[model samples]
Target: MPYNFDDEMIDEIREKNDIVDVISEYVDLTRTGSNYKGICPFHNEKTPSFMVSPNKQIFHCFGCGEGGNVITFIMKHLNMDFVDTLNLLASRVNIDIETKKTKRNKELEDRNKLLFNINKDSAKYFYENLQNNKKALSYIRERGIDESVIKSYGLGYALPDWSGLLEYLLHKGYKIKDIHSLGLIIQRKDKSGYFDRFRDRIIFPIINNRGSVVGFGGRIIEKNGQPKYLNSSDSPIFNKGYNLYGINILKKYARGKDVILVEGYMDVISLYKYGIRSSVASLGTSLTENQVKLIKRYGKDVYLCYDSDEAGKKATNRALEILKKEDVEAKVIVLKDAKDPDEFINKFGLERFYETMSNALPYMDFKIQLYKERHDLNISEGRIDFIKEIVTELKKIKSPVERDVYLDKISKETKVSKDSIKEELKYLPIRNYKDKYINKNNRDNNKDRIKPVINRLEPGYTIAEKNLLYLICKDKNIYESVKTQISPEDFITEEYKKIAERLYEYYENEEFLFKTFEKVLNDNLIGTLENIYNTQINIDASQKNKVLEDFIKTVKIKKLENKKVALKERLKEIDLMDSKSEGDVEKFKSICLQLINIDKELKLHQ
Candidate 1:
């Protein structure tokens, strides 16, 4: 059901949910002067560049240019839609939104409800089958899975019979097509009948963030099986790339802790049983950008606990690249003398696992170590090659202090001089180093040119427009007076013009809060608005009038200067003609008069 929320109801929701309070649930904000500061959740930064203004009810990240109000923050942070964010906020404020469901939406909702019911029943059937199947139960029990742990995780088993799930679903009054759509049963290719998807395997029901069973993953109990693990194919409700295996439980425990990303379900389940609850795994696939984004919603830091084998290291490297691209603070956990987390925890116990986690190497350090082992640092050529590769990796470090620290480490390990390493770092081009590691053939040709950092400063006219908007946003009286003088066209930048237009609309509706316009603004415009709001304009009540007057004058002067340039160009065209008509002469005369008037306006501003 979709709700048609009126402006007043939306405003009421915004009024009740304070931006600072809402953002505090995800970001750790500390008071810094008049604003709250934290590491920007949208990107990785050592410094606290993410600022939230309680007075203005808006947040701005000076690092990544992510800015918005409460609802906007939730939408970006949680990767949810506008209506979903509104409903979530409404729930927080104890407001029930009145929604009308169309026939199509109602049917979709009913179908989804049916799918959920089918998945739930299938999970129960598998669980009961687990208890009756001695071999499956013994295999699970031998792997250190207890009864309580099994129940908590909804661990189950599929009987060896092919028609086990098919017969059960039919008896439960679920259509075969519905069960097939849920990935519980597979339709026969010959169109003869349907068969169970999972048979003779231990089942792990995949639950979504909303606590609904959406799919399943099955693993063979016996060794040397053809396929070790089988997962449900992609369905309407389940996207393995977007959802983590144990995130439903990980979200609860990962509030203030770093999430441990493993490669298998047993790794997650075992770690959870060992009392390390902040663990999640991708569903039998490689790490993805969407999954990384999902992990970021819970915490900024992540620990990659994949297997320490050759393939595992490659997977870990790939995951590191994805996490780095997503601006997530990631570290790699290397387990010794064990195949995976399950075996490591079982062999070394939880204390040693904790120690290993505490001693996990930073991503750069891990990469350096891996490269050192790969290159023969015993010889001069090997050392030179290693140094070049390490310097390339070092250049990716954004913080000067962190880069220097690693430079010292590389110097100590390779017996190379720190000065020589620093010199090499200075010469290395600022290319995407992750691409070099991920794809050797995809290296950029223009690696000698340094990549420029994004500039946050707007142009002169843009600055004036933003200043004027800031004034209008801060004071309602200023909004009315400013609106009367300057129109949205006065803003030179298109983004600023859009913001000015929205501000006028909100002001017309008597909704003064900047948050009231968040739902209507895009991310870039929201960022612009936040930057404008966050900018400190040192003007008293008496001086505010003068400042607003000056800004308006500057905008008018810029507009007039643009008009003068166009008129002068037209005059040049008219002069270039061999024979000018009487109307052309009159037009040239009109342009000259307009240019003179524009000059006078510019002089007045000056």
Candidate 2:
């Protein structure tokens, strides 16, 4: 049996959990007039466009058109299904839900829970092992990590002996196949038995945003080890690309401040220990787009604090491009005479590290300075090339004021005339000012303009459908009255038709809460519906009935017109045939009669 939640139970869970409190955990929202606003977690934008209404228990993003109630938000944000999201909320509010689970589902769920327990037990085993292992303990202490930091990060050590974790998990009643699936134990080559995956290493458990120990990162105690670090392979629950090392702990500290993005696990732990708690690191991988968006959910600003080596510089450049795509503000931290944050903080006191962070350069400034250093600007050719590059970068700046400021800076630096740079900018190719993350799909579509099939529907039809849906969402009476007069087929757009059908179902049940309807809608539909609901169509109370009537009439006329055009096209094909059968003639006559009837209907509506 599948888990089924009654409407009343869902309603009770939603009523107990406030939307503002739930959303605030993921989005940094601030009160804006009657509603709270924050950067949308769905899409990247600089200005705050995501709005949450406390009174309505709904949220809407004006920028990306994402809107929905509390359940919808959690489902989309965490990428969980309806039942899982409901269970999570129910647990939060201390409501016990009677879930119907099949034998297979129950087995899988039990296995997953056991995996979590195994990881927890493994972490504790490693922690106790660290207390006994003097070499690993001394190595961590030498790296400036204290006992408090060790306990806070759950630092541990794997014993030198093989089959340590294997024996422990097996003693705890975990099967070899299950432990192998978790990447904690490996099957022997000879098919004899299993052995521990981690041995003679310092262990750092990788926790997810939900505070679950999903994976682990290990550092070798001996200096002769070939690889300095080893991370858990991809498993059922953890993907290195999606999980950050310290984000579970960082979120609370990064609420209102910019996030400090470092490169390694030690850097994050060390920074957190030294009072800089808003820091996280990618787990043995390059910074990914998913990681950047994860950071965006916590804060708008990101400071790149990777190592100062050439590889680190390249990594920073790659990260900046991805962050720019998401419209996140990025800055580069260049430490003097230090390779990374750990060494910098260790070499100089915490105050010096804070000073360097405070004086971090904006991405563009850092890029320009890097370019200047690469080229010999003393020569005329080199100077001209530098100026052209600066102008190209300046064009990417969306704001005219910001562009002018950078242009003036370039003019002073290179002794180039501002007018000359401005003239060069005019001849350069036009660039789309929209955020690349949101505009990427549209850009791809534009490249396929030669495709024969295109959206040929009139804009007026879409407007009419949207307006009617908006009006219906605003007032339940409007929805109830309109559903009886017009079916969902009357709507031209598929999205609008879906919205209409869902709204009709809700009102038909006499359920007035919009949050109840949110359970059935996905993220995209929720955003679009929220967009429609939030749009203010100012019609006087006395004129709302007339406006709604006119909108319905417009949609009906558009539908009839579409049918007329389609019928005429079919008639043309019929006329072009060499020989017409009696059936074809009868079909033509039928179409003509239907067209006449549709014309009369349209006339009456008009």
**Number of the top-ranking candidate, with TM-score as the measure:** 1
The true-versus-predicted C-alpha distance at residue 443 of model 1, in Å, is: 27
- Across 1-606, the per-residue lDDT of candidate 2 in tens digits comes to 123454566678889999999998777799988889998867657999899999989887756445567987887577676677888999989886755325435665776688888888889899999988889899988887889989888999999889998898889888887787778876675779878878899999998887889999888888663357767765656656677899888776677678999998888987887898899998765566677878878765789998887657756766776778778879988889988898888789799998998899897898788778757788888888898777777777899998898888888888888998899988876543222222334545566454332223235456668888876654454676688779987888888888888887766654233334555776668757755644434443333466577678767877887899899999999999999999999999998899899889976864
Instruction: Note the Cα lDDT for every prediction shown.
Output: 0.78, 0.77
Q: Stretches of candidate 2 above 4 Å error? A: 1-108, 187-193, 384-392, 430-606
Off by over 4 Å in 1: 1-104, 430-606
Q: Which lDDT tens digits does candidate 1 get at residues 1-606?
A: 123454556677888999988887777799998999998766657989899999988887766556657876886677676677788999998886754225534665787799889999999999999888889899998998999889878999998798988898899898987887666776675779988878888999998777899889999887543356777865656656668888888777776678999999999999988888889998765677878888888865799999888657767877887889888869999999999999999999999998998999888988998898779988989999999888877877999999989988889888999999988888876442221111112223444655454334343456678888876765454676787789998887788899888888876764354334555787667656756765434442223465578688767867886788889999999999999999999999998898888888776665
Give lDDT: candidate 1, residue 186: 66
Index of the highest-lDDT prediction: 1
